[model samples]
Each structure stands twice: as structure tokens, then as C-alpha cells.
Target: MQKILVAGPTFPDVIERLKQYFEVDWNQGNALSGAELTQRLADKDGALTAGELINAAVLAAAPRLRVVSNMAVGFNNFDMGAFNAVNVLGTNTPDVLNESVADFGWALMMAAARRVVESEHWLRAGEWQKFQYDAFLGADIHGSTLGIVGMGRIGQALARRARGFNMRVVYHNRSRVAPQIEAELNAEYVSKEALLRIADHVVLVLPYTRENHHTIGAAELALMKSGATLTNIARGGIVDDAALAEALRAKRIGAAALDVFEGEPRVHPDLLAVPNVVLTPHIASATEATRRAMANLAADNLMAGLGEGPQAGHPPNPINPDVLGKARRS
Candidate 1:
């Protein structure tokens, strides 16, 4: 039987399913260090990871590795160029977590715009004597111009939710989405600068790429309305966290919320010190059902990518499909 390394903690059911076809080496403790990951993969034929880095060095050490199944929609953890060079397939769980992530994006936006976290902190400190007329005043979500960066599936889902709030949706993407999709969602295409300048609330849903690094930086933040809110549900490093922290401290923009951070698990101290920001530990798709679906899909990818399971030889969400027929193993 082919040996598989299940990196990071995952549902037991996913492990059991994989055990049906492969010898499983499950890591249920804290995240493994780089050396440990490389050592473990030395004897493995494939791996199912949840954000562990699988770069060229790791890939080089794992000569037997043919496939890597990422549990999340964002496979920024995988070094695509190396995977392609070595004919190693990488797959990610996409649509399964779209709605859940969209819902969380809304949560973050609302929390930031309404000063939810800030006010709650104050109230908990026994600072609420009486409700002042202007206490915790915040921007309105209804009748607002909502700007979305990267109008993909999750972005469309956000636009759909905007309808109920009576928000006007404008999005900026690498390329405009289909006209029919825009019409269906009543969304308008705009330039990134235009979106930043005019939007009452800006939500980022773009994937992370070399060109997209720090897509929102000091200059972009300065373009936003002083009272506008910013929310990011996308990958980390897409926004300059330090710049955002400075902006928040200066109140350059009204408020900001982040689900992912640059060099995360280690947020900028400035951001933590600021009171106008709401931060979550990258759990935009943490709903039990959605996470389970993601895990199952990842398992499916690992099985099929290795030429096993019901969908033998056909992984559903291959990141580099060109490497399919040329995989090193199988």
C-alpha cells in the first residue's frame, strides 16, 4: 500500500477514510517544524496538509511524493512552480467553503463598521455608565457602496448578500467577471483605485500571488474614506498589516478587520495595540459542516490523485492539472 502523511490535526473520520487505501502517518500534535516535515515526507508517497509549507526544498526531500491535498481553498502553502517542475499534483478544497467564508466576511465587516469589538471591550471594563447619544457611532451597512476586491465565487456570494442590505456592489478584479454574472448580482466592475476611493466598506477576497502581495498598502488605505471600513477574508500578506495597523492608530480609515495576517500566528504588535480593529485567527470557514466538507474533499483529492477511490485518476480540484498525466509516482 502507498504511504501517506497526514500533516496537522484533522478529523478522525478523514484519517479512517484514508487508512482504507493507504498507510497513514497522522500528526495530531502541534504543527511540525520544517526539518520534521521534511524528515517525515522522506518515506511518504503523498501528503494531506492544512497550510503546511510544501516548497521546493520539502519537495526535493520527498522524492516519492506524487500528490499533496490541501484542506483549504487557498493553497498558497504549496510552491506551485516546484510542484509543476517535479510533476507533483496539488489540489485544494474550493466551493465547499465559499458560502461559509462569505458569511464570515460579512461578520467581520459588520463588526468593524459598527465598532462591535471596541464597544464590547469597553462595556466589559464597566465603562458603560449610560448610553450616550453618539456612543460608538459607526458607518451604516445599508444604503452603502460595497467594494469587493477579486470578484470570484466568494466575492459573488458577498454581492448576493449585499442585495438584502440594499448595498450597491462594485468590484475590482484582474479581469471583469462575466456580464451575466454581474447582472445577476447587480454588481458593477470598477478599477481598484475607484473601489478604494468610493466604497463605504471594502472587502478583499483575492487569492495570494506574487503580483498581489500587499495589494492593499499605505497608499491604497489613504485612498479610502476616513470613515470607511475594510475587511479581509483572503490570504495573508495580501494586505500590509503594519501599514494597516498604522492606519488604524491614526484613524486614516474608520476601522478594519482581518481573518488572516502577514507572518501570522504572529500578528503585528501595533495591530493588537489598536482598538479599532477586529482580528480573527483565520477561521473564515470554521463552520463545522463546511470544515467537514473541506476535509472530505481533501481526502477525495488525495485518494483520486494517487489513482485510488471512486474518482480514480481524476482529482476534482487540481491546482496544476498539467502535471496530471506526468506525475512521478503511479
Candidate 2:
């Protein structure tokens, strides 16, 4: 049997299924360091990863490696050039986590718009003696303008939810989504600047790429209305955390919520000091059902790409299928 490395902890059922075909080396503890990952994959034939960095060095060290299946939708951790040069296929689980993530995005947006976290902290601290008319006054979500940056699957789902609030939806993407989709969601395509200027609440659901680092920064924050709320459920580095902290401190923008940060698992000290912002440890796709679906899809990709499962050699979500039949790097 071919040897496989599972770079992160996964569902036990998924592991049992993979055991039927391959010799599995599962990492159930802390994330492996770069040196440790390289040493471990040195002899493995295939691996399933979750947001673990896989670069040319790791690929070069793993001569037997043929495929890498990523458990999350974002594959920015993958160095595609290296995978292509070595003819090693990469895959990710998409669509499965869309609704779960969308739901979380909405939760974060509402929490920020309504000052939920700040007020909750105040209440827990015994600061609520009496309710004043202006006490914790916050931006209203219903009948407000909702702007979404990066109008992908999750973004569209968010737009669909806005209908119940009677919100006017505007979105900015690399290109407009189909007319039918826009009509169904009642989302209007607009420029990023225009969306920032007009929106009462803004949510980010875009993928991260090198060129788009800090998709929202001080300048963008300056463009937003003073009462607007911002929420990001997208990848880290998409927003400048320090800049966001400053904006929140100055009340340049009303409030902010983040599921990701520039360097996370270690949120910026500045953001932590601010009371207007709500922070979560990237649980946008943390629902049990959604996480299981991601794990199973990743397992399926690993098995199929390695030519062992029912769909042998035809993994459903190949990121670099062009490398499938090419010569493997020695």
C-alpha cells in the first residue's frame, strides 16, 4: 500500500476510510514545523493538508509524493509553480463550506453592527445599571445598504440572506456574476470605491492572492462612512490588522469584526485593545456537518488522485489537472 501523510487532524470516520486503501500517518497534535513536515513527507506518496505551507522545498524532498489534497477552500498555502514543475496534483474542498461560512459572516456582521460583543462585555462587567436611550446605540442592519467585497459563493449566499432584512445589496468582484444570479440575489455590481462609499455594512468573502494583499487598508477605511460596520470572514493578510485597529480606535469606521488577521493565531495587540471590534479564531466553517463534508471531500481527492478509489485518477476538484499525465520530478 502507498504511504500517505495527513498533515492535520481530521474526522475519525474519514481516517478509517483512508485506512482501507493507504498506510496513513496522521498528525493529531500541533501543526508540524517546516523542517518537521519536510522530514515526514520525505517518503510519503500522497498527503492531505489543512492550511499547511507546501512549497518547493517540501516538494523537492518528497520524491514519491504525487498529490496533496487541501481540506479548506483557500489554497494560498500551495506553491502552484512548485507543484506544476514536479507534476504533483493539488486539490481543495470548495462549495461544501459555502453556506456554513456565509452564515458565520452574517453573524459577525450583525454582531458588529449591533455592538453585540462590546455590549456583552459591558453587561458581564456589571456596567449595566440602567438602560439609557443613547446607551449602546448602534447601526441598524435592516433597511441599510449592504456591500460585499469579493462576490463568490459565500458572498452570493450573504446577499440572498439580506433580502429578509430588506437591505439593498451591492457587491464588488473581479467581474460581475451572471445576470440571473444578480437578479435572484438582488445584488448590484459596483466598484470597490463606490461600494465602500455607499454601504452601511461591508463584508469580505474574497480569496487571497499575492497582488491583493491588504484588500482593505487605511485608505479604504477612510472611504467608508463613519457609521458603517465592517466584517471579514475571508483569509488573513486581506486586511491590514494594525490599520483596522487604528481606524476602530479613532471611530473612523463604527465597528469591525474579524475571523482572520494578518498574522493569526496571534492577533495584533492593537486590535485586542480596541473595544469596538469583535474577534474570532477563524471559525467561519466550524459547523460539525460542514467540517465533516470538507474532510470527506479532501479524503476523496487524495484517494482518487492516487488512483485507488472508485473515481481513480479523476479527483473531483483538481487544482492542477494539467500535471496529471506529465513526467514526475525525480
Candidate 3:
């Protein structure tokens, strides 16, 4: 039987499915460290990961690793160049989590705007001695500008949510969405500068790439309205955490909500010091149904990648499709 290293926690069904075709040494609770990940991949023919920073060095250590399937939609975690060089098939779960993540993004935005977490903490501390007017006063979302960076499916979904609030939606992207799509969502394409300058609430939903590092930095932050709220549902490194913390301290941006961070699980110390910012531990797609779907789709990708299943000879959404012809031949 083909050997697969299940390097991260996954649903029970996924574990069972892999066991049907491969011997799975499942790590149900903890994913592997980079050093441990490389050592474990040394003998395995396949791996199912969840954005574990599997890079070229990791790939070089895993000569036998033919395929890698991450349980999440974003493959920025993988080093595509290395995978292509080594002819390793890489697949990701997409579409299943877009709406769920978009919903969470909107919630985070609302929480930041309304000072939800701050108020909750205050109430918990028994600070509600008297009902005071203008306490925890916040910016209004209704009739305000909603600016989105990296306008993908989730970004568009977020735009649809704004219509009900009577908000104007503007976005910045590498390529503008087709005019029809813009009309459908009632969104306008704007320059990054324009979006930052005019948006009352800015949301980020782009992918993570080297070129995209610090897409929102000091310069971009300076352009936003002083009292504007900021929300990031995208991957880490897209925003400068230190810069964000400083901006919050200076009241440069009214408030901010972040679901992902630069060095996650080890957030910037500065962010924890701010009162106007809301932080979450990267749970935008953490809903039970959505996470289960991500796990199952990852299993499907792995099974298909191993030259089995209905998708034999054609894995869904290969990041490096060039490897398929080579993998099949090998």
C-alpha cells in the first residue's frame, strides 16, 4: 500500500478514506514542525497538510513525496517552484470556504466598527456603573464607503453584503473584474490610492505572495480616513503588524480587526497593547461545516493525485499543472 503522512489534524472521515488506499500515520491533533515535517516526509509518498509552510527545503528533504494536498483553499503555504521542480502534485480546497470566510470578515468589520470586543471586556470587568451617553461611540457603516483589497470571490461576496447597509463599494485588484460583474455587485474599480483615500471601512481579501507583502503598510495606512475602520480576512504578511499597531496607538486608523497576522499564534506584541484593534486566531473558515468540507476535499485531491478515484489523471486545481504530465509518465 502507498504510504501517506497525515501531518495535521483532520476530520475522522478523511482519515478513514485515506486508510482505504494508503497506510496513514495520522497526527490527529498536532501538525508537524518544519524539521519534523521534512523527516516524516522522507519516507511517505503523499502528505495532507493545512498551510504548514511546506517550502523548497521541505520538498528537497522529501524525495519520495509525490503529492501534497493542503486542507485549506490557500496554497500560499506551499512553495510552488520547488513542487514543480520535484514534480510533486499540489492541490487545495477552494470554493467551499469562500462564503463562510466572507461572512466572518463582515462580522469582524462590524465588531471593529461597533467596539464589540472592547465593550464586552469592559462589561466583564464590571465597569458598567452608569449608563453614559457617547460611551464606546463608533463610526457608522450605513452610507459609508466599503473598500476591498484583492477583490476575489470572498471580496465580491462582501460587496453584496454592503448593499443592504446602503454602502458604496470600491475595490483594488491586479485586473478589474468584468464590467458585468461590477454592475451585478454595484462595485466600482478604484486605484489602491483612491480606495485607501476614500473608504470609510477597508477590508482585505487577497492571497499572500512575496510581491504582496505589506500591501497595507505605513503609506497605505496614511491615506485612509483617520476614523476609518480596517478589516483583514486574508492571509498574514499582507499587512504590517507593527505598523498597524502603531497606527492604532496614534489613532491614525479608528479601529482594526484582524483574523490573520504576520507571525500567527505568536502575534506581534504591539497589537496586544492596543484598545482600538480586534484580533482573532485565524478562524474565518472555522465553522464546523466549512472545515469538514475543506478536509474532505483535501482527501479527494490526495486520492485523485495518487492516480485513483473518478478524478484519476486529473486532480482538481493543480497549482503546478506542468507536473501532471511528468508525474503520470514517472
Candidate 4:
């Protein structure tokens, strides 16, 4: 039997299903460190992985390693260049997560802009005095200029949320969306500079890539309107956390919310110091129903990529389809 590995704690049912088809080596903890992870893959022909660092070095170590089906939507943890070089396959669960994450993104934006978390903490501290006239004054989401750093499915979902609020949507992408799309969403295609400069609120939904590291750095942050609100439901490292902390400290932007962070699950200490920022542990797609859907979809990817399901030979989200050649449609 071909050897398969589950590289992290995943749903038990999913593991049992993979066991029916492949020799299963289960790692029941969270992701292993880089060295230990590579060691474990030494015998795995394929893996159902969540957040393990699988790069050229590991691929070189595991000559038998063929497919890696990641349990999450972001595959930035995989070294695509290395996977492509070795003709190894990688896949992620995507569309199944769009709405859940988008909903959370909107929630974070509201929470940050309206001082929801800060005020809650204050109230919890037993400091609920009589309602002050200007206590925790916050920016209004309705009729604000909403800027989106990415215009993918999740980003578009967030734009749709703005519809009831009558917010104008502006976006910056690698390339522009079609005019029809813009018209349909009541959105405008803007340069990154323009998007940063004018919008009252900014949201990030972009993928992480080498080219996109710190896409919103000091310079980008400088362009944002003062007292604006910012939210990130995208991957860590897209925005410079240190710079963001500085901006938050100076009240350069009124507030910020982040569900992802640089080098997480270690959130930046500076972010913790700022009460104006809302922080969450990368749980944008963490609703119970949605999380189960994501897990099942990830299992489906692992099953298909390993040649065991209805999709047996047709894994749906191959990052490098060319790498899988005969393995794909066989």
C-alpha cells in the first residue's frame, strides 16, 4: 500500500477514510517544527498537511513524497517553486471558506471601527458608569469609502456586505477587475496608492507571496487617511505588523483589527500593547459549521489527490497541475 501521512491534528473521521485507502501515519499534534516535519515525510508518499513547512529541502529528503493536500486555503506555507521543481502536487480548500472568512472580515472591520472590543473590555472591568455623551466615539461604517486590497472571491463577498451600508467600494488588485464587475458591485478600480489615500476603511484579502510581503508597509500605511479603520482577514506578513503598531500608537489610523499576524501563532507584542487594535488568532473561517466544511473539503482533496475518492484522479485545487501529469487523470 502507498504510504500516506496526516501531518497534524485533523478530524478523526478524515483520517479513518484515508486509512481505508493508504498506509496512514498520523501525527496527532499541531504542525511539527521544520526539521521534525521533514523527518516525518521521509516515508510518506503523500500527506494531509496543515501548516507544515514543506520546501525544496524537505522534498529532496522525501523522494517518495508526491502530493500535499493542505487543510487550509492559504498554501503560502508550501514552497511552490520547490514543489514545481520536483513535480510534486499541492492543493488547498478554497471556495468552501470564502463566505465564512468574508463574514468575519466584515465583523472585524465593524469591531475595530466602532471600538466594540475595547468598550467591551472596559465594561467587563466593572467600570460601567452612566452613559457619557462622547464615550468611545467611533467611525461610522455606513456611507464610508471602503478599500479592498485584493479583489478575489472573499474580497467580493465583503463588497457585497457593504451594499446595505451604502459604502462605496474601491479596490486594488494585481490587475483590475472588469468594468462590469465594478459596476455590479458599485466599486471603483483604483491604484494601490489611491486606495490607501482616500478610503475611510481598508480591508486585506490578498494571498501571500514573495512579491506581496509587507504589501502594506510604512509607506502604504502613510498613505491611509488619518483616523481611518483597517482590518486584515488575509494571511500573516501581508502587512508590516511593527509599522501597524506604530500607526496605531500615533493614532495615525483610528483603529485596526487583525485575525492573522506575522510569525503567528505568536502575535506581535506591540499589537498587544495597543488597545485600539482588535486581535484574533487566525480564526476568520472558524465557525463550527464552516470549519467542519473546510475539514471535509480538505479531506476530499487528500482523498482525490491520493487517488481514492469520486474525484479519485482529479484533485480540484492543484497548485501545480502540471506536476501531477499522469497522476492527475489516472
TM-score of each: 0.99, 0.99, 0.97, 0.96
The weakest ten consecutive residues by lDDT in model 3 span 321-330
Q: What is the C-alpha RMSD of each candidate to the true structure, in Å?
A: 1.1, 0.8, 1.4, 2.1
Error of 1 at 20 (Å): 0.5
lDDT of 1: 0.95
Give model 2's clash tally.
0
In the range 1-330, model 4's lDDT, one tens digit per residue, is 889878877678867877788889998866688888888888878888878788888888888888998888899889988888778889998898899999999999999999999999999999998989999999999989999999999999999999999999999999988888888899899999999998999999999999999999889889888889889999899999999999999988899999999999998899999999999999899887887777788778777877777898688888788876543211
| Tens digits of per-residue lDDT for model 3, 131-157 | 889899999999999999978889999
Q: What is the lDDT of residue 166 in candidate 2?
A: 100
- lDDT digits (tens) for residues 169-275 of candidate 1: 99999998999999999999999999999999999999999999999999999999999999999989999999999999999999999999999899999999999
**Candidate 1, RMSD to the unseen true structure:** 1.1
As for candidate 3, its clashing pairs are none
Best by lDDT: 1
lDDT of 2 by residue, 25-142 (tens): 9999999999999999999999999988999999999999999999999999999999998899999999999999999999999999999999999999999999799988999999
Model 3: residues >4 Å from true position, as ranges?
Answer: 328-330
Q: Given candidate 2, what's the lDDT at residue 286?
A: 99
In model 2, the worst 10-residue window by lDDT is 321-330
Tell me the whole-model lDDT of each prediction, alpha carbons only.
0.95, 0.94, 0.89, 0.88
